[model samples]
Target: MVLDAYASSNPDQVHEDVLQKSRDACYKARDAFYSCLEKESGKKPTEIASVGLLYPKECSLSRTEFVKSCRSSWGPETRGGILEKPYTFSSSSSKFVLLISDVSGGDLFMLEFMHMMTKLRPFVHSFLKEASKMFVLYIYTMGDRPYSRQMAKLLDPKGEYFGERIISRDDGTVRHQKSLDVVLGQEKAVLILDDTENAWPSHKDNLIVIERYHFFASSCKQFDHRFQSLSLLKSDESEPDGALATVLKVLKQTHSLFFEDGGEDLSGRDVRSLLKQVRKEILKGCKVVFSRVFPTKSQAEDHPLWRVAEGLGATCATEVDESVTHVVAVDVGTEKVRWAIREKKFVVHRGWIDAASYLWKKQPEENFGLEQLKKQGTDEKSDDVNI
Candidate 1:
């Protein structure tokens, strides 16, 4: 009764200095209360930043801890385990469920290992072995010739997939740019999987943008991405449904679609169109709106992010309405964000759009919540900053 009275009488409800919690307990409460706020905001983390909440002040500590922890509890493994079936294409903000509020300190290593493996995303041996069948594979990188050859040896030890097909920076025609001109394959039939889009400015139609695998502080700093490299983490993506596995499936489809006979010569068929058709399946029917993601003077349609979203087949509108399925924003304080929360619409950061575009599938919106993204999207004008 005294504690309750003190809590009620306290003028500053925003602070949790009155209570001290364990590492696990603090994070757990934070997750629970955020989970609660999400429920209050209509069961989606993207729904509201933190509207009027029923949570006590102590949970606020989790937000502070969150900056330090930052989704250790929200790994894809936590999202897996029968709660979600494979190929489940649901909204991450609202419908997603967590099996545990916070992983115990003892299991932190295992969770981190899983997340590390997922993010590390090494060149899959099986994927390469199989991929060699459908298409002629090559390793064209910005890395120096010696480093490129060494990495290629590590990837294709037998020299089966890319035997002498490797091209490095020294062999390129342009400076600080990657071009398909160095590649002998026909542009229409070739498909490129690269981490950086600017590396292939003229061949985006032929490019499949894969998420970068940052393993070093040097790479992170070079990219200006604030997140720690996966090299710092402990180990694994689930083998069955991880990025490599998913990409292989997509590759198979692309190959099938390209060779799909229509009693016409395959010479004129463009794999780029087929690749775009497959990529568009990710956010095909969704309508997205932007909130402070674009510069005030720039046309939203002209923004690279807008083009990426539209390329994924989502309709982008400046204003929100019933048809708006998502409002992509970096600022949680924006009016559009507020309207999205009240309307129970999915409110996510711009990374969600890019993630969908990169993975060629819809990423969990909860993972890219505005609050979650503010750390990365501090400079909203840096939309070109790949997550």
Candidate 2:
């Protein structure tokens, strides 16, 4: 249904008719296989314990051949090969950074897999162009071999960025976890960018978590989320100052720090530690207090805002003191708000902390003050009453 809708909207971009026919053929083949299993097991289709147990050898072969033929007719196969060597760089350059990045939900989101309609995440091409100058870029994805290669082609059409360094699920371990063992060269020198942290549990020190990109309805559905997609909204993240742009700056800083000391030994240097230090400095030297932000009777220490403030290097206190630099409040009539006004401290809304967390930078207080929030609340309430 999603594909149909996308195809209708983008008639020239997708081969919806061909995909629909192919889907019908697959359905018919599946139904035939199920019927054969039902007959062999001497039971109804729903009563069969395992379809593989009753599947006949001849029927299995026939079904496999049919599917293979369908795939061949649908699209060309993706090419695969071993990467021989890294791309040539200037001889004067001092360092070569190793980067392993994911594809789906990281660089782009698949809207129609059959027709191959994808929405690229914001700043993807710009980020790649900037990072490629400092790093030997590689593509790592949990998707199948053909799909990964196809996406790599789309992302690097000129073949200048990721040259044959594409690793898919077929090349990874049987346990479905990515390991540095498969990656050649020094493990400590390599940095990984991926949206899903659990995919690389063993290499957390080398992994930098990225915000997941959801640009299609099916992509969000796969993760059990129902938010509006970028395609549906007809908007994308800010290209000039988006998450990818911010991450590129961090990557550049990490690369610079790795080669800063002019030392021969680069084994001890880790980008993860640098990333932590950069994050810790975002809200450093600031003391914060919250009012009417947590549920009544709930521990303030256990609240998410408290943990976020601490994580961003802010000191959280229940009571306002002389050192209080900011007061996070949702209500304008709170005592803390009045105290912050009297003390001339920054009195901001709950979104001030959230925006900093998402943008990885401190947002201006004037943009998220109590007056703006009150006006927003009034407008929403008026709309609700009218509805």
On TM-score, the candidate that comes out on top is 1
Candidate 1 lowest-lDDT run of ten? 98-107
Q: Whole-model Cα lDDT per candidate? A: 0.60, 0.65
**Candidate 1 local lDDT, 194-248, one digit each (tens):** 7677877788787776665554445578888767654454333445665666677
Off by over 4 Å in 2: 1-93, 96-100, 103-116, 174-179, 185-187, 217-229, 291-308, 329-338, 370-387
Error of 2 at 81 (Å): 23
> Which residue pairs in model 2 clash with each other?
none
Q: In model 1, which residue pairs have backbone atoms overlapping below 3 Å?
A: 113-235, 113-236, 117-235, 117-236, 118-236, 118-237
